[model samples]
Target: MIGNVPSDFRLPTSDSVIGRLADDVVLSIEDLWVEYQTPAGPMQAVRGATLEIRRGEAVALIGESGSGKTTLGLALLRLLTRTARVSRGRARFRIGDGRTLELFSLGGSDLRRFRWQECAMVFQAALNSLNPVLKVRDHFIETARAHGRKDDRQTSERARELLRMVQLDGERVLSSYPHELSGGMRQRVSIALSLLLEPQLIILDEPTTALDILTQRAIIDVIRSLRQRLNFTMMFISHDLSLAAELADRVATMYAGELVEVGKVRDVFYTPKHPYTVGLLNAVPPIAGEEFTPLTAIPGSPPDLLAMPSGCSFHPRCPYATELCVRQAPPLFAVGNGHQAACFHWERVTRRLDVWEGAVR
Candidate 1:
C-alpha cells in the first residue's frame, strides 16, 4: 500500500503525471470470469479468478500458456479482444482521489479515458505495436494528444525525459524508426511509453520474453530501478517462476483457469502447499555448481476448457488424487496464513510432499 498524494499535488489541465495518487488497495478483483465466443461454444478462459493487488507491490502471476494469466491482466485493463468478454466479475480501481472507478463497468470511451491516467499495461511484444514508419517521438506525441495534451512542446520534453529515465538517448530514439532500434532498445521505448502517462498500476505481461540473457538482465535492472523510483504497483506475469521470483513480492500459481495457490514469494518457493505447485518448483533445474540432481516434469497436458473434467481439473494428473477429487470440485481451501490451495487432499498432500521433495531435491 502507498501513501496518499501530497496536499499540494493537483491534476494537470493537460496530460501529465501529476494527479491523485494513493497507497493501499489500488485494485480489487472478485471472481473474474472471461470467455471467448467460439464457433463450437463459449469457452471460459478465466474461471472465478479472485485477486487483490495492493499498492506499491509486485505480484507475479505464474502459469503456462493458456492458463488465463494474460487474459486476467487484459481483463483488469478492460482490454480483452472483440471475441473475448468478461461474463461475470467486478474490478474496482481506487484512484488517487480516494474515489473508486468500477473498471468492469467502463465503456470503450470511458475505459480509454481511465487508462494511462490511472493504469497502463506494458504488453507482450509491445514494441511490435509501434508503427514501423513513424519516429518514436511521434508515437509519444499521439499518445499525449489522445489524452488531451495540447502543448506538443511540453509533451515532447516529457517524452525525452521518460526515454532518459529508461537509459535511452532522447534525441537518437526520438528521431529513429522502430526498426532502427534493436529489440531491447525498442522494448525500452515501449516501457518508456507506458510510463509516459505515469499510471499508478502497470501490468507487465512477460515484458522480458524473447530477449538474450544479457539484454534480459539489463531490461530487468532498468525496470527494478524505475519501479523503486516511481512507486507504481505492478502485476508481473511470466511462465518462469525463477525469473518471476526476481521481481515479485508474492507469487500466484494458476492452473487451468483458476488460481490454485498464492502466498509470499519465499513461502511459495520454499514451502509450497499445493501438489501442482510442488511439481512446478521441482521442475526447475538445480543450480549447476550444486550437487547433481534430476528434474521432474509435471505429467500430462492442461485440461481442455471446453470439456473440462467434472471435479478438480488437475486430479487427472495429480498422484495424490483420491476418489473424492474425481467426483467433486474442491474450492480454494485455506491451509494457514494467506496460503490457499484447491485440493481434496491438502493435508495428506503435505505429507506425501516430504517424501516427494526428498526425491526431487
Candidate 2:
C-alpha cells in the first residue's frame, strides 16, 4: 500500500501486533562482523551479531558510547565508510514481493535502489545530513527523482503528508532551507524525507540527539504515532534506556562490539540476565521511586576495540565474572522465551538483583 511496494504488499494492521507470523522476518542478520581499517590495526566494530526483526516492530539497540550500536546499524544499510568493511556476514532483507535480498551482495544500482526504496536511514546529525544549498522542498524532490519518482506534484504532496505526520507545517518547511530551520525542524524534515520513499524498514540512529528534552519528547511521540499509523519496521540506535523502554518492543544491548543481551522490553528491563544489562539499568534513575535512589555507574570505561580483552569482553567490568569468564567468551545462552544473554553466570545475576532489592528496602 505504500510507495513502490507491490500492490499485494500488506503490513500488519497494528504496530502492537508483533510476531504476527512466524515467518514475518523483515530483516535477518547472521554472524555479521564489521571492521574499520586503522593505522594501528583493523578495529573490530561489530562482531558476530545476529538478529531478526519481525514485521512492524521497533527494535532498539542500546549500549555505552563505543558499544558498536551505530556500526551495526550502518552495516545493515551498507552505508559504512570506505575505511570500514563487512569482514564477513549475511544480511537478508525481505523485499516487497517476499524475495530475500542479501544486502552485502548488492552492487551498482541494485544497492542504490535498496538504500532508499526498501530501507532508509535517518542519521544522527540532521544538519550534516541535509544540503545547505538545497531548500527543504528541493531535498524531497531530489530524493524522489533519484528513486525514479519524477512526478513533481505527487512527490511534493507525499512530502507534505509525511511532514504533517511529524507535526510540521509542510508548506513553510518545504519552502525553507536546511540552515533556515531549527534543530528540531531539521530533524523532522529528515524524518519526512525518509518516509517519502515509503520504505518498509527504517533505521533511525539517535533520532533525538542534541535536542532539548521537550523536543526529544515530541520526536518520540511523532515516531510512535507514525509507526502505529503506517505500520513499518524500525530499528533505532540509542544510549538512552528510557527511550528504548518506551519506543521498542525488543531491546538489544551491545557491548564491546557484540550483542550481550536481547529480550522483550519488559523482560530486559525487569529481569535482565546479563550483568552488563543489569549495570545499565542500575545506572538509570527510576522515575516512580518514593525515596531518592542513588544511581550506580558501571565500573570502568568501555574497552579499546583495537585490543579487546580476552574471553568475555565485559568480564573486566562484571562483578559475577569468574575464572571461566576470564578464559573463554560465552556464546548467547537462552535466558527466557525469545530472550538471550551472553553471560556465564546468568543465574547469579538474577540472584544478585534479588539481594540488591532486599537491601534497598
Candidate 3:
C-alpha cells in the first residue's frame, strides 16, 4: 500500500521558508504526561507522549474523540485547564535563536514573555472566541498591546497586514464586529490573530471542525498559503484523517493518551504499522476505487482512560493482538524508514492485512 506523493497531493512551499523540511527539531517533547487533579484521584489524560516537530512543517495529531489529542496539544503550550497539570516530561523549544528553553520550567514573567511571542494557539471554537462587543480592530489592538506593542499606529498597520495576509479586506474587516463576519471569515481572523506576534509555532486545535466541507477546504488552503508565506511551523490537531492527509508532512496517531504510530503521511496512511492506525485508515471512505464498499469500523469503542486496560491500550480492539500484547507494554518498533509502531506482532500484522484484503474481494 506504500506509494510516493500521489498526483493529486500538494503542500505549501516557499523560497523564503526557514529550515529544511524534516531537518531540524524545533520542539523536542519527551515522555510528556498530563493529568486532571480531582478529589477522586489524579486522572491521567495524556501518557508518555513523545515526538519532535520539525521547523516550517505541519505535524498532525489525529485520533478518535477522547484520545487526548487536545490535551496533549494544550499541555505542550501550558494552556491546560486550571484543574489539569503537566506532572512529568519536558518540551525543549527553540525560537529564532539556536538556544533552547524548557517551556514548563519557566515561571511568571519568563513564561509570559516567551509565550504568544514565540508560540501561539488557534483554539477549537475560535469563531466564538471573539468578543461580541468589540470591533475586529479592537481584538487585534488588545493582542498587540498584550504582547507589548506600545505604538497604536504600528499595531494598527500590522493588524491590517494580517487581515490582508488571510485574504480579507483590511478596512472592512477591521471596522466590522465578529457578528458581521461569516463563520469561515471569523476563523481566518482568528488565524491572523495567532500570527500577529509572528510566532515560530502555531497550535491549530481543530480549526476547521465547525465549518462546512467546502469551507473547510478553503480554510485549509488559506492555512497552506499562510504557512508558505510566513514560514511558521504548525501542529494541526484534528480527528479528520483526510484533512490531516492534506496539511501534514508527518502524521502522529494517538490512542488512549499514547502515540501509537508516527511517521510520514504516506507511510501511516498507505502502509500503517499499528493496529489502531490500520483500523482508522480502513474506516475512512476512499476517494477513488471502492467508492461503494461498506464502511469498515474498528469494531469497538476506545478504552476508558480512568480505568484503562493493562498492557497495550489498543490490544483490546486489535484483531491481531495476542497474549504478549495483553501482558507487556510494547515499545515502539521500527517498521520502515523513519516509521515506528508500538506493536509486538507488527510483522505478523502486515501479513494478516494482505490476507484480509484478499478475503474482502
Candidate 4:
C-alpha cells in the first residue's frame, strides 16, 4: 500500500509519547485457556497464561514453533481456527478513542469490523495474506475505503505515502501485484496495510521469517521506524529470540502452552531466570559481541499436550528440574525489576550460573 512515498521520510514516534496520550491499558489477557478438540480429546494450547501490553509498548511472544505464541496472538484477536476454541480467559482491548471491547463476547459484524480497524494482524506468510490478483494500490484503497476515512484521492496519496514509509517507490509498487514484488517488499506492503486502519495495536506473527537476511534487516528497520513514528503498541510473535530482543521493549517466553518467563528485554536476555528462558537464550546466536560462544540447543523436544506431565511441562527437558518441579507447577513469581519466572528454583538456577560470562563454554 505504501509505495514510493519517500525514503527520507521521518520515522514514527517513541513509546513514551503514546504512553502519555492513552494512559489506560490497551490490551490485557487474563488467565487465558485455549484448547483444540482433537480426536484424543481437548488439547490445551494456552493454559492460564496472563499478559498485558500497554499503549505504544512493543512486546514479543517468543517460543518454539508449537509453543503457543501464534495461538496466543490469534486468541488476542479472536482469530483462532474452527477446531481451536477459547475454553477460559478474558482478553480486554481498550481502543485509542476510549472504547472497550471484550473480544470473546463480540459477534460477527462487530468482530470483523474491529479486526483490522482497531487491531490488525500481519500473519507469517505474505502470499497467503495478500491477494495476488490485486495491485498494491488497489489493496490499500480497499482497506482505506472500508473504513470510510479516506476516498479515492486520499487513498491514492496515502498509499503512495505508506509505500514510502516502508522504503518502497510508490508508483512502481502500487502497480505491482503480489508476484511482482520480492518477499521483503510484500511484507512491507502488508505492514503498510496493517497501518491503514491506524489501529492502536498490530500483532506481527513471524513477520520476517520468510525473508533473506538483508531483507529481514530492512523489514526490522521499517518496523522500528513505524513504531517510532506511529506510537502504536505491538505484539511481535516470533520463534526467534534474537530478533525479538532487538525489537521488543519486553519479552514473554512460552513453553508447552504456558508462560515460563516475562520481563524487560535486557533482563530476559542478560539475566534469564527460567530454565526454558535460559535454554532459549543460549540457543540463539549473539548479536552484540563477537567474543560470545556458540549457541547450545535445548536437549529434548516439548511434551505432548494431550497427555502432559503432572507438574511442570518443562520438567522433562530442564536440567535444573527437581522433585518440587516434578511434583507441582510453579506460578510466575516476581524475581526483580519487573522480571518474573515460573520456576521454583529460579534463584538457585540464575545465581549458580552465568552462561554469557564465557564460563559455560
Candidate 2 segments whose C-alpha is farther than 4 A from its true place: 1-22, 351-361
lDDT by residue for model 3 over 1-361, one digit each (tens)? 1124333222112221233223287888889999998777888888998899988879999999999999998887788999999989877776554545577776665566557888888888865788899999999998888767878788889989988888899989999999999988899999999899899999999989979888898899999999989999999999999989999999999999999899999998888889888878777776788558555567668887888888998877777777887899999999999899999987766523443332311
Candidate 2 residue 41 C-alpha distance from true site, Å: 1.0
Cα lDDT for residue 30, model 3? 86
Residue 71, candidate 2: Cα error in Å is 1.0
Candidate with maximal TM-score: 2
lDDT of 1 at 258: 93
On lDDT, who's better, 2 or 4? 2
lDDT tens digits by residue: candidate 4, 218-271: 999999999999888899999888788779999999998998899999999888
Candidate models: Cα lDDT each: 0.82, 0.87, 0.82, 0.83
What's the CA error at residue 63 for candidate 3, in Å? 0.7
Please give the distance, in angstroms, between residue 66's alpha carbon in candidate 3 and its true position after superposition: 0.7
Poorest 10 consecutive residues of model 3 by lDDT?
A: 8-17
Q: Give the root-mean-square deviation of each candidate in angstroms.
A: 5.2, 5.9, 9.0, 7.9
Model 4, clash count? 13
Ranking 1 against 2 by lDDT, winner: 2
* Model 4 alpha-carbon drift over 4 Å, by segment: 1-22, 287-292, 351-361
